[model samples]
Target: MLMSAAHAQVSLQDRRPVLKGIETVDDPRRIPRKPAAKKSKITVLRGGRVFDAVSAAARSATVVIEDNHIRAILPASSTDWPTEARVIDVTGETVMPGLIDMHVHLTYPDSDANIDEQGSAVDGAMRGTRNLRWLIESGFTSVRDLNGVGEAPYVLAQWSADNAIPAPRVFTAGHIITGTGGHATERPLTPTHGHDYAIEVNGADAWRGAVRQVFKDGASVIKIASHFAPDEVEAAVDEAHRLGLKVTCDCEGIYTEMAVKAGIDMIEHPLPRTDATITLMAKNHTASVPTLQVYQNVIDRNGGFYGSTSRRFAMTSQDDFDVFKKMKAAGIAMGVGTDTIGDANKMIPNVYIAELKWFVKGGYSLADTLKAATIVNARLLDMDDKIGSLEAGKLADILVVRGNPDQSLDDLQKVDLVIKDGIFYVENGQLVTPRHVAQPLLKPSPPETTK
Candidate 1:
């Protein structure tokens, strides 16, 4: 009378699977305009050990990318290849989700070189083109730019989307909103503090205006300067949500407490938060991105060195180290971020490992720290469905590190390869870009050739 689940079938089946008794048309002319041109040819990556961040053990697996997304994760034994398919042999490496850092000042460089004088129409794009490879070489495949210094983050992000740059997928908040004389408004040099154009809103009304302004200018998230007042912070979050953007804050103590109450989406800091503050943050689903690396790099100016840039940027009593463990114990969400600027003199490939090392030193288990940087950040980005793990149908945002991150967080410093958006940016810890200088090339080059 009725077909059982196994017996049910479709008529005139093609290569594609059936959906609800309808089969995808095999006729080229009949296929839809949107998907026909971009149909993927399978690319199989074989002989790789997997360190799927969510999984407990490293499995030998075959990863297949179809178009821009991962199509399948096959077992070690499955070698069935489609004709004309490309195969990548990763004989000895570990594959895991690409790293995610929530707080990055994309506009900053280690030195004071004028990148402005050096480039074409795409200043940020060019800088990103150079730096993206550096990030990938250090095993990062995604970053959340906390601030856009020179209108560069957007170009880099768009170029990455245009498949022009071999960098990690970037989600950026165009600029940070700060009160007229807020911490974000303060600058290191000059007798008179300059207004941070990044965010120069005055009050609740101005905060409300920035929500729409940031989105129109191409921000996926809205950030508000909150150390000034809790009610002021709440107003911005409320306004940003109506326009459809997640709200993040850069503040400490009561600023964070009020933001949690206001329903801020995430907090960016080393979390100068207390145990009570951590509990409230957890209850409110507020995530924290401890840009500890940046803050830790805070050199003491009063100690006869350069001014502590981190201390200058920080607000309130909570910006200390103890807050991290208390927050971790209280079960607050954490994401990876390195506010540190890097280049040749720094001797660091990327700031991510620096952030991870602190988590290990600060008493988080290695696995938890990895989860914070990878899975947790993905979840915060609303990209968990696409990149957090080696899941099918997700984009192949992955990295292979030198040692097992599961064994120790310190091993994270040794990078192996970085693959983002199904493109290889690095292999064997070397940037795939042609020989170029990381120092002088932080400006736009000819888009046609550099790409």
Candidate 2:
């Protein structure tokens, strides 16, 4: 016999459910060795024009990094240099904060794979690990995985943080939360694959519990889908905000309006939204990710429609593009995300670059597009104070590219170097495994010397 939603709710509230496979331990021999003790080192980058993400243009400057944080950004003419610092000369290059992708699905299969043949959790893990490499190589130092199969994304995030894998900083929403048979829940249900991508629930109370479940499972952000009752979404937003996590919704039309009104922090796509919905989003300061490239890909692949014949959603590429333009014009805060789930190999650099190009095509300057990808996206992630810009006392996630990206958007393709957490992940246009260094343990000063 199957359990009813009401009965399931009682069980969930009685005892927290642990995510499947979270407690499994890997073989000791397969575990990567712990990081070596951290040693402070001073490194200076000289002769490169820097785009601090706060400035209108890249200017000649010298950046000094101490350990894993930026110690200073000195003027080009200043000569007060640290004597022991190792300096790397980057004459004629552009140095800036590493790029961020506000949305991604790291567990999805390659573009050529059939959608119906979704893989197992182990397959998702392997696919995600491969995708992480492509992301970092393309200069994305951090990404937020909006959804993934089972516990795959969460496990991958932990692995990336532990330096057990060569990957970017990862923030993940373990599984999307949606109403029963809702958007992300449309996948074919089988015994093993059921609820792999999203959890289905009914009623406002169940909605709140769903939020708690994902939060307890180590989700850094909450992702919910629409076609839900107004009260249900409202309960979810309230619960997530109470837990100190921001909520992002994947919705269109009336659903979008409801989410914005319910205080959703972010909306996922540039799907059709009314003028009133746009106004409300701007007024409420709700940000949008406007994943234009993915929708455009759909149109291109389907001969001008945004969806297949059976699920057309009655929208077109131009329709979505127009909504994106209007949202930008309304002064709504927006970020960049490539909702490139399939064909990532062929789609990544192109999709990500195309998204920025669309921004420029819609009246944004080259510098504006760069900021959208850096600080603006960082702010959306609530990580602006730490990783967004080339500022002192910020994490050393810097990127050096061959040309002036602020002047020519295409120049961003020339990724010469990438530094995350002061570790060199890519140098001279080549990927290298960095030696992990763990922070030294602080010991209590020997019992205050009885002076």
Candidate 3:
């Protein structure tokens, strides 16, 4: 479920129901590993001013891609070009690491609706497949879905690999863990619904058990929602770390202090936080995903709770904005995310660009903002070693834009090409790979019957 950081609440003495049948096993099949395909093509993307995320500035260079990894980054004047490799000249463009969005929801496509509950599995799958395509075409090569409904994350990963879906590399936290009656609670609060979208536990022991279940269910990361007790948060973080998974929490309110104290690895929208809390987060080396775009979008399009509160926040003071600035100044690692849920037209790729603009408007340098979207986000996902930058030995996830984004952030919207895992997925702002279509098992009968 989507939540705004503005509605964060907590009850220190909240009691949890003692339920039975909380069972899980360390299933070996949890984390799927795709067998490496037969060696891929060796294609060298050349003659572009490369912006390796680690570099101080963009430089004229030639990137040599072999198989699925970057072989080397050579000076633009190098003469030793391999004859067997296919070289594509990307002159006059900025070649940088493919973008990464830190927070997203693949299961919920429409913000105005809950597709997970309203539609069939096939319906959700089709929407997710299409959304993935839209993101990749818009220059995002990878994203982390913060929450998903039941086995959807694993299923999506399998489809991308087993069926060769042309989509961004996806990482997911299978389900959000929240306290009983917390932000993500289902209305009826039934057991089936509890397991479907969230793990609503009570005590520290229950939190640990839920975290174990999440790992056993194939989540690469664990997410905890707002309103959790300090011990519960600590136990969740401890169990996740012990199990080799990172933990991120929804710090929509005062939970920021609790999350930081619990040694949480990342905080989603660690806003409405005091400078002391921001400083504390930096001291603890906790990363953050400030999904400011969601608030702005809500304010612009709807006057719902998120919209009204966001408006008030915007009008009241630059408090949150100043907090974000303090976060960056305090050396808190910030990653970019557009928590946009809705139709693809205005929500997707465009929302990501809007977030970038907000970062610049928030006083972040263009280079720092781009880094937050790329390498910084990659690091937040523990994928920096493979996919973050345009460096040798890294996976070749590249984006070529028409103009230098360093000079003007708007140039990012003009993506000329997108390359993921050494494959050219988009060229000249057009999709090039074969589309992945979800074939439903059951076809709709008549319109009336289907309804």
Candidate 4:
């Protein structure tokens, strides 16, 4: 009888002879492959002074991260970390929630006076990509882009998710909605060019239609430019609210009162207003994003950025500052925003530090200043649950700095490490990973010598 092919493939003398009911296996490649080992998802950050943001004091703690959320915040003296966890010793560092910028124009990257005119949509996208990476390494893990040109903001949002670009989590308002010829058009050289930053529509119906269009265009927030009719303002706010989107308005003078009365959720760069208007804004629970850094820049340039209006500039004009102080007294929420336009080189993270110092000068304590940048801003974005505080169960968007920001506002700029979604992006003041495009190191310029 002829032997089976399996028995014929093997040496008959080398193996036991195959019986009629037995089978022989000689193929080496047919051996079973063992399963690959699973990578560990647990990480432990030990020996850090954690700033919980809710309290005025820092405490020694160990933050245990499981996947993307913080699993536990144990006492620093505890030694209960899982043996499989990767531990990062942040001894002597100040660990706090990552910073949040309430307002920005990610697509606008020019320090020149004609920033709005210098870039096309494609150019803005490229520059925006670079800026986003810089923001993340600088400790800003999330941003609210109030006005972004074309599809740049939406594209950046997707890129950030795909890790095509290392950008902060973005909540974008695609374009500013304005009256036919308002603040959005005042600077752009031509009416057609104005569409780069804003869309012009007239009448209440037009305002409602514009709000719907922007929502369709993927805007999470609705930003109405200054100088719209009262009915238009009311219509925009009502429509945006109905659509479950909050309304933020760039308001000045009488329009500020109108916007507040119309139930607008936030006001940007609020113009100096009457006491009645300020009180009304506080009463209405409307928040403010004071882009004091840009205002101070205008003042520093001798008002050159605003032409004749530059001379009139002050860091929150005395009267306006007084009103804001009063509003603060009334429990109105205020957050910091740079609003720096032009280049990534010009609008570096230091601008944010400068803004914090101005807040300090304006009588905000270090704790309140930090709160404004983190918890308060997070609340403004309606993300207080998921971020803003170094609490258990929150996404691990955190910063480890060299010193206590509560001691010196300047320490906020000392970003020794940045972590987003439980992933380390910056360590030892350097970017260890670049998601898509590699970012070049940007060093600060030396102080100018006096003549």
Candidate 5:
């Protein structure tokens, strides 16, 4: 059997073996003696102010994208582009790296009515697919799903990577690993919802096993819950690191201290932490994704505090802001995440914008806030080297907004264009059909007979 070059390339890019029972021909004679040289498809954005995500400023420049990687970022005056390059004039626009969201739950319902409903896998898949499209259309080219329901996230991740669906690049931590009756396991386990949101395991060895299980299920990162012994957290962290992955924890107060001590790479929330723990986190370079917007939503929807009986009642929005300020003053690495579980259409831009505004309110400059959403969030995902900034040799995941977002984050909502992996998904502030979807799917070549 023979496979097309395109199919073989996709397999290699995925770092997975080809499907079973389809053996590729190994005969040298059957291969082309001299394959035709492929021409590079070049697209240039001319006369745009480029914000590369490194400097805290945008400069007038031209970006030359060749295939799926940036070829160069030339000066606005430079006309040194290939004659075949398709140039698009982007004067008065801002071209920057695509944004990233470090924390999201794609499988969760997008509305209040369905929030507590026990949906099946098919329902979860539908919701997740819808969320993925909303994320990409909103200028998020990459996202990390911290706790997805069942296999929905893993399957979605694969689909997004293969361009089988229109979605941002997805990195997921299959299910939350927690002790019995821990943070994520609070809901009653029904037949449909049992162990889909979280897996309750006990003991240090059990934590290690949970880490291994999620990794086997194609999770690139590990998410663990709090209220566990120090040794258990340590075991989970060690197992994840050994597998060449990072572990983040969703815990507060003493649990935060324990997770940090266990060498957790990131903390999920801006929960109350002692000054000593903050110092330790800064010293150890532990990253944080303070999902302040989610907590604020809880308070707002429930009228003031999340009710007097709720554990979160004591923590006010002001308290969340104060904790963020402290973390910033301590030089803790922070990223952007909304943790939105409402109507994506109504909540995405609003929730995401609110998160950025909170960062500004917490003493981050507008430029720095944008960085947190792009390169900084990429660093949190350990993917900065590939897709964080707009630079030569990086993936061509770029965004062009109508106004200067570095000066005012509100202008970020004007997403004029978005390009992921060199394919245009959005243009003129509208979503377009992806190239893969518009074209016929690649098929394997028929086997050739030996002469």
Candidate 6:
């Protein structure tokens, strides 16, 4: 039961395998980069239970992560493993890919229950740095941050890329584009709100300019509130795509329909989609991210406009469960995104467990539910080449739990080990980097006096 220490897929092409090619993808385990004979930083996670993220099945395997990358996965028992490298023996544990939450607010601060986006760029950067540490420690190795103040997300993205900071892999949406008074826009009554945060553009021409601004700022993904017109959605999609970026729209009513029609890449918050709408989405290759639990949080709060808690919760009650089943049956690309960003679910990893229940109620058999979170969502982020599955040569983003997650979804809450990019983040349920920052992480500042 010795898995080969060599596994590297030649990407930069379709699934065309080229085992013997000159231009190969970087393989840390490949034949010595040169004659220097570089040493490997290997970590053999000895005995553990692993969720076959690719196949969505649990398998007893010995996975070795070397030099911050996965080297191999062997189908063998963990009896007597090597002692040289960093090793973790989770004899009675389960493992899967670190979770991906497509919707999160790393820079959005809150007081009471309302999120505030009026922070300075530096403030956002500091908050994002702190949030990234919490995210990775909590088992989220990757995240699609919606929007943040200024270029704060981009700075954080660069930090994690260098591993100068250990945090979740970030796919940033930069800033949001919105119509005159869309959700992202500030209300006149709310003085604390930052009206300048969203790129508020009304006409198609204005949207084009905004898209150019976001592109200039290096946005990995484009996000716009489609509460405007179909023409507006179409214009945003055309411009954003022209710049080689995917567009995600946040909406519920006609906005969703417009977004799907205008060839939007994805939609957040799965509302009750119609049969015609579902068909259009399937045909147009559009995806829906049902941030159901987030919607539930809004319902729990029962704020103004949606006033009644029980009624608002019942708003998408029928639409919630069936939308996923119908989409799955219709062969539409339905990805997973946890929109719940406050209270207990504020910690990203906890949302993955609740998200399963949303799909479960939608007639998704347990296996498919897990797949949607791991592989399905990974593919949407255009990061399938590196992450998503427990295959060799991929970045070793793994999670080992106490019980089979499929049989009992709650088993994930009791994770024994979490490995991301060959780094063992959690060992036996205790994080290598603890989440809580009880004491101040900020350095000392000198006092200032005015004459």
Tens digits of per-residue lDDT, candidate 1, 69-135, equal 7788888899776878898787676677888766665545544445444222254455556666566
Compare candidates 5 and 6 on lDDT and give the better one.
5
Expressed as tens digits, the lDDT of each residue in 1-451 for candidate 2 is 2223343111011011232222211110112344456676988999999999998988999999988889999999875666988889999999999998888988876654544565567888898998888878878888889888878998998887765776777878778888877776554433222477788899989999999998877787789976688778888887777775788998878889988877789999887789999998999899999998887877777766534211237667788889898999999888999975667445667789999999998889999899999999988877676787999987898989999999888888999988887877888878897556878669855687787
| lDDT at 178, model 5 | 84
What is the C-alpha lDDT profile of model 3 across 254-336, one tens digit per residue?
A: 68788887778888863577777888888889888877767655555654234221112332125546667788788888899
Off by over 4 Å in 1: 1-36, 111-126, 187-197, 299-319, 341-350, 408-414, 433-451
User: In model 2, how large is the Cα lDDT of residue 123?
Assistant: 80
Q: Write the per-residue lDDT of candidate 6 for residues 1-451, one digit (tens) a residue.
A: 1112142211212221333432222211112223224367777766676676677567778887776667788876543435677776767776677777777766665332333433667776787787877777666778887876778877887677556576777777778888866656544423113453567788777887888887777676788874577667777777777665678887766677877877788888766457888888898878878777766666656631342211122444445657667777888777777753444335556666777787887777788888887788887776676788777877788877777777888876776766776766667677575566577759875668664
Model 2: lDDT to the true structure: 0.79
lDDT values for all models: 0.65, 0.79, 0.73, 0.74, 0.79, 0.68
Off by over 4 Å in 4: 1-40, 113-117, 187-193, 304-320, 343-345, 434-451
- Model 5 over residues 371-426: C-alpha lDDT tens digits? 99999987777677678899997789999999999998888889998898888888
Give TM-scores for every candidate, taking all chains together and pairing residue i with residue i: 0.78, 0.85, 0.82, 0.82, 0.85, 0.80
TM-score of 1: 0.78
Q: List the residue pairs that clash in candidate 4.
A: 109-342, 109-343, 110-342, 110-343, 111-342, 111-343, 303-310
lDDT of candidate 2 at residue 101, scale 0 to 100: 88
- Runs of candidate 3 with Cα error greater than 4 angstroms are 1-40, 114-121, 161-163, 186-195, 302-304, 307-317, 343-346, 434-451
Query: How many clashing residue pairs appear in each of the predictions shown?
Result: 2, 1, 3, 7, 0, 4
In angstroms, give how far residue 425 of model 3 lies from its true place.
1.4
lDDT of 4 by residue, 20-132 (tens): 22322111111133433545499888988998888887899998887767888899889786898988888888999999887888877465445445456787788778788
